[model samples]
Target chain A: MSLDKSVVNVSFLEVKVWRGKDDGELVSYQVPGRENQTVLDVVSEIQRSHEPSLAYRYACRVGVCGSCAMTVNGMPKWTCRTHVKKVMDDGVLTIEPLRNLPRIKDLVCDLSPFIDTWQQAGAPFCGTKTRHEAPANIDPESKARKAADAGLQCINCAVCYSACDVVSWNKDYIGPAGLNRAWTLVNDARHGERQSTFDKAFGSGGCGSCHSQGNCTRHCPIGLSPSESIAGLKKSALFGLPKV
Target chain B: MERSLFLTQRLTAMALGPLVLVHLGLILFAVKGGLTAEEILLRTQGSVGWALFYGAFVVMASIHGPIGLRNVLREWTDLTTGLINFVTAGFGFLLLFVGIRAVLAVTQTATQISG
Candidate 1:
C-alpha cells in the first residue's frame, strides 16, 4: 500500500481577532496551526486564507522593526516575537490593536497622537555645530552618556504609551515614550536645546505628570525603564524650577 | 506651578515616610502600654522633642495631601489645570493653617499642663 505522502497534516487553532474600527467587535476564525507559529504568523494565516480584508502593520518579522505590536490576550506585545504556543490559552488567542489609541481599522491603531507627543515633549535633537566644524567626540564613559544609554532603545512602538495609565487619563500628558526620548536628549552632551527640552519636560503634561505607576517600564518590549527616566526628570525639574 | 508642586510632593513624601513610622511607633507604644489621653498628654507636655516631631508631621502632611489631591482632581475631573491648581493651592494653604493651628493648640495645652 502506498501512503499519501503529499498531504500535510495540520491542526486547527481557534483565534479571536478584533474587527472593525474603534466600535468594532472581535471575530473568531479557525486557522491552521503549525509548529513554532507566532502571533504574527497566526494573523497572517487568517488574513491570507480566511479573511483578506484584515488590516495589521508589521516589518522585520524578526522583531527589530517594532511595528507589529498588538494586544495579545490582555497585554501589549510584539506580535512577531510572541509565539502562539506561549500566549495561547486553551488553544485560543485574542488579538487586538494597541490600547489607549484610536483604532483606525481592524487590528490597526492610528499612531499619530503617539508620535506627535514626541514633538510636544521637545524630543528633537538640535546640534550647534556646522559642517565646517569637527564632530563633537562624546566620551562613552561619561555620566550623561551612560544615563542616555539607559533609555535609548525605544523604537516608537507605542506599547509604553498604551500601557501608561496617565496617557489614558490625561489627554495632554506627554506619556512615557515621549518623555523617555526627551530624557535621552537631556543627557546628551551634544544636544543643543537642553534647557528648552528641560523646560518642556518639567512643564505641565510632561514628566511631572507621570505618577510613576511603572506601567511604561513594565510593558516595554525592549526593557527600557521610562518610569526611572521620569523620576530623573522629576529630580531635574528642581533645576528648571528657578526659571519658572 | 506643576514643577514646584511635584518637587514639593516628593520632598514632603520623603519627610513623611520617616515621620509616619515614628508616629505609628509612638501610637503602638502608647497603645501597648494602655496609656490614656491624659497620661499621653503628660508625657508630651512641655517636651520639645514631641513638639518638633508633631510639627514636622503636620507640615509634611499639609504639603503632601494637597499635592496628591491635585493629581487626583486632575485625573478624576474635567476641571482645567489652572482651576485645579488654584483650588489645590487654596487647599494647601488651608491645610497648612489648620494643621499648624492644631499643632500649636496641642503644644500650648501641654505647656499649660507643665506650667
Candidate 2:
C-alpha cells in the first residue's frame, strides 16, 4: 500500500499523553494524522517521531489479543479499534492508562491486581474429566449452557474491569470481568469445582458488591454484559447452590 | 455471611415493594377527607388486618434498611467490616424495637382502650 504524501503531511493532531505513574502529568505532542487513523496509530507516531521514552503496550494492532486498551478521552477503550476521529475533541486527543489499576509507566498499567481479582472470584475452570476421558456431551441449547455462552467471549481485556465503578469505589470488590468468568464456569457442567466457584462468588467483595450500573456492559468492546452475568450469579444464589 | 445478607436485603425489598405502594395509596386515600389522629385510630384500632400489614412492613423494613445501609457504609466509608457489621446490626435491632413498639401502640393500645 503506497502512502499518500499529501494526506500524511496535511493534518496534525494535538494529543495529550500521560507521562508517568500515579502522579503523572499529561505531556502534549503533535502527531501527524492520516485518514482513518486510530488512537494506537497516534501513540505509535508519537513514539517513533517525537518521544522515544513514551511507554505503551500494543500487539496484533487488529483488536485481538486485548493488549491495546487505554483510557481515551476519559473512557476506557481498545485504542487499536478506536478511531482518532471518533474520540478526538476538536482535533485534540487525550490518552492515559486504564483506571482502577496500578500504573506502571505512561500508558501501561499493572494487570496483576485485575488477575488476582479473577482468581479470587474462582474464575479458573477445573474440569473433572482426565486426559483419557471422552468429552462430556453438552446440549448447546440448554439454558445453563446458553447462559454460560453469553459471557464466554471475554478476552480478559480488563476494559470492563477498568470501567467498573464498584471496583473503583471498593478496592476489595472483584470487578465485572472476574464475576463474568465465574458465571460462565458456574454454569459449565464439566467444571469440577462449581460449588467452590459459587462460594467465592457469593463471598465478600463478590457479586453482591456489584452496583448493577452496567458500566462494564457499556464500555466493553466485545459487547459482553458482565452486569448481566453478575445478576445471574445473584439470582443463582437466591435459588440455591450451584450443582457440583 | 455476605450471601445471606444479600438474599435478606433482596427478599425484604421485594416484600416492601407492594407494602410501600399500599401504604402510600392508603395515605393518599385517607387524607382525601382530611384525616386526624382520632379518625386514624378509629379505623385502625383493634384491626387484625392493619396489625398484620404494618407488622410485616416493620419487620421487612428493619431487615432491609440495615442491609442497604451496610452496603453504603461499606462502599463510602473506610470503616472496618467488623465495625460496620456491628453498627448495622445495632441499627437493625433499634429499628425492630421501635417499629414493633409503634405497631403495638397503634394496634394493641387501641384494642385495650376500646375494649
Candidate 3:
C-alpha cells in the first residue's frame, strides 16, 4: 500500500527502539506515519532504510510464528501483530526486549532460560503405549480432553513468561508458559510419566511459586490463560498427592 | 516442602475467608451497633461456640500470616528458604501460643462471673 503524502507531511512517529545488549541505550528512529501501519513495519523500515545494524527477530510477519514478541510501551506484545496506531501513546512508541529474560541484543532477549523452564516443568509428553499397541483413541468431548484442549495451543512464545511477575521476582519460578504446558500434559491420560511430571511441578521452582497475579493471562497474545492453567496445576497437585 | 506450603497457604486462606468476614462483621456490629465490652463478653465468655469460632480463626491466621510474610520476605529480602522457613515457623508458633492463651483467658471467664 502506498503512503499518503498528506499523512507523511503532517507527522511522524517518535519511535524509541532499544539498541545494543542488556543495559544498552534506546536509539530513536523517525519513521513517517502511515494509515494501517504495524509496529513491525516501522522496525523493518528502520532496518531497511535507516539503521541496517538494528537487530530484532521475526518470521512469517504474522502472529503464528511467535518470534516477534517485544516489550511495546512497557507491555509485552507480539510486535508483528501489534498495530502502530492502536498502541501509540502520545505519538511515541517505546520498543524493547521481552522482560524477565536476559537481553541478547536490541529487541532480542535470550530464550534459553524460558525454554529450559519448560523442560524443568516436565512438559514434554511421553506416551505409555508401545509401538506394537494400537493408537489410543481419545474422545475430544471427554472432560479431561476438554480440560487439556484449553491450554494445548501454546506456541512457547514466552509472552506469558515475560508477563509473569512471579517469574520476574523469582528467577527459578517455572513460569506461566511452562506450567501451562505442564497442565496440558497432566490432563493427558496416555502420558507415561504423570507422577514424575507432578513431582517436577510440585518442586521448588514449580507452580507453587506462582502468585496468581494474572499478568500472564492478561498479556498472552493467543488469549491462553496460563493463570487458569497454573491454578489447575495447583489443584491437581493438592488432589493427586497423599495427605501430608 | 514448597508444595505443602502452597497447599497449607491456600487451605488457611479458605478458612480465613469466612473467619475474617465474621470477625469484621462482629467488629462492625460492636462499633456501630453500640455494644459495650461487657455486653460483648457476656455472650462470648464461657461460650464454646465463640471459643471454637475464634479458635479456628486464630489457627488459620497463624498459618496464613507467616506463609504470606515468608513470600513477601523471599521476594523483597535476601533471606534463604531455610532461614525464612525457620523464622516464619517461630512466628507462627508465637501467634498460636499467644492467640490460644487469649482465647483460653476469655473462655475461662465463666468461673469469675459465677464466683
Top of the candidates by TM-score? 2
Q: What order do candidates take by TM-score, descending?
A: 2, 1, 3
Task: Highest lDDT: give the candidate number.
Answer: 2
Q: Which stretches of candidate 1 lie over 4 Å from their true place?
A: A1-7, A238-244, B31-33, B44-49, B109-115
Better of 1 and 3 by TM-score: 1
Which ranges of candidate 2 are over 4 A from the true structure?
A1-9, A241-244, B109-115
The TM-score between candidate 1 and the true structure equals 0.88
Interface quality of candidate 3 as DockQ: 0.56
lDDT of 2 by residue, B1-115 (tens): 9999999998899999999999999999999999899878877878889999999999999999999999999999999999999999999999999998888788776448566
TM-score (second chain) of model 3: 0.88
Fnat, model 1, is 0.82
DockQ of 1: 0.64
TM-score of chain B of each: 0.85, 0.93, 0.88
Worst 10 residues of 2 chain B by lDDT: B106-115
CAPRI quality of model 3:
medium
lDDT of 2 at A73: 95
The local lDDT score (0 to 100) that residue A57 gets in candidate 2 is 95
Write the residue-wise lDDT of candidate 3 on A12-94 in tens digits. Answer: 88999999997799899888888778899889989998999888999988788889899999999998888998999999999
Q: In candidate 1 chain A, what residue range of length 10 has the lowest lDDT sum?
A: A235-244
Q: What TM-score quantifies how close candidate 2 is to the native fold?
A: 0.95
Interface RMSD, in order shown: 1.3, 0.8, 1.4
